[model samples]
Target: MAVKSDFLVIGSGIAGLSFALKAAEAGRVTLVTKMGPEETNTKYAQGGIASVFSDEDDFELHVRDTLEAGAGLCHEDAVRLVVTSGPERVRELIAWGVEFTRSDNAASNGYDLHLEGGHSRKRILHAADITGAAVERAVLAKVAAHPRIKVFDHHMAIDLITRRKLERRRKGKDRCLGAYVYDTKSGDVEVFVAGATLIATGGSGKVYLITSNPDVASGDGVAMAARAGARIANMEFMQFHPTCLFHPPRGKFSDQ
Candidate 1:
């Protein structure tokens, strides 16, 4: 039997939950995660989101920093969209109960911002050192209480279900219908049918032997999307952080 929803969201990271929260306003949403809802790359993120929030900062400066970081491969349109909409998105997060660190400066908005390697201004909006965790906590709380959103933890998506899988006779294009999920606890494969499906399963950090990402970052979403004939881009670019918290035996310090 297939359970149906208006929108199906895979993963529980900042992207997934944030999308689900907004989508729920229009229709019913089914959110699926491989582990507990809180276990995600977003929960492990220490740094903050960058935006032009200071009197000294501007969109051009932020875009220039991002372009430099991308090493000339960045898309100007995408960069412009993010830089322009970042402050409004941050305000939305605050409205959802995310408390960012405050500043004592009288000229500022009272929220403490930090400067990173590529940026020239202190435009990083953070909740102390665990900005992602703070954002995740607040967003997940809203998702849990929303009547239009249903969360399914410990459910792993094996593959995406497309129109080809349904054996439709008159197919104009290959459209995604839903997915086949595996319940880790019950050991059962279930069908989740939806009008639309979203894949926001973070990165493929676990593909490397050692990484700062959580165990759930197994590149499942990327694999599923590729298998479903989606064109993937920028796979050659891999960003590795210089410092990762070392855990004995499992995670050791990397010199690279």
Candidate 2:
């Protein structure tokens, strides 16, 4: 069967869902997820969004701290952009219905920011402990309510439909038209066509024998993009957190 949309998004995490919501205003959007719509690594994030929210604290400090944390390899232009635009992103999140905890309590009426290990100030905005869950929920709710957005659950992409599939003679360039997807319920192949496509599938931690990631974190996007002539970077580095609790049976943590 053939399905059509103006925009097609593979993965329903924060990036995919947000792109779908934005594109829906102008055209039809089809969002496909491997399992349930909410099944994503974003829902499991415990850390908060870092942003300048206090008069005492400023953007320069946030930028410097982020650079320091990123080490010498951090890009100067990218760091500056983040530091300057951080506050606006925070305000945008608030306008989208994200409720951040207030920082000062009775003394002041503003966002209560926390400091991560790399952060220089109390600039990380959070909601109690599970900040990412809260932000994801808010964004998902709004995206779900948008009539232009259509979500397909339990659909997995088998492969991308490219120019080579059409026997094109082009040597250096290949174009992505759509994808061949497998419908788990019916056990049949479906072709989804879109003018624009976005792949927001998260990183692969499953390739490792042990990780804090979900079962679906198998580097699908990276593999797919690589096959389409995209370069892969930083495949060798793996950061191990000493604070990561590893039990015999439990992978990462116990129910809080």
**Top lDDT: which candidate number?**
1
Query: Model 1: number of clashes?
Result: 0
Q: What root-mean-square deviation over C-alphas does model 1 reach?
A: 2.9
lDDT of 1: 0.90
Which pairs of residues have clashing backbones in candidate 1? Answer: none
Clashing pairs in 2: 102-112, 103-111, 103-112
Off by over 4 Å in 1: 168-172, 243-256
**Candidate 1's residue-wise lDDT over 48-88, tens digit each?**
98888888888999999999889889999999999999989
In Å, residue 181's CA in model 1 sits off its true spot by: 0.6
Q: lDDT per residue, candidate 2, 7-87, as tens digits?
A: 889888888988888899899998888888787878777888877777778878887887787778789899999888877
What TM-score against the true fold does each predicted structure earn? 0.93, 0.89
* Local accuracy by lDDT, each model: 0.90, 0.79
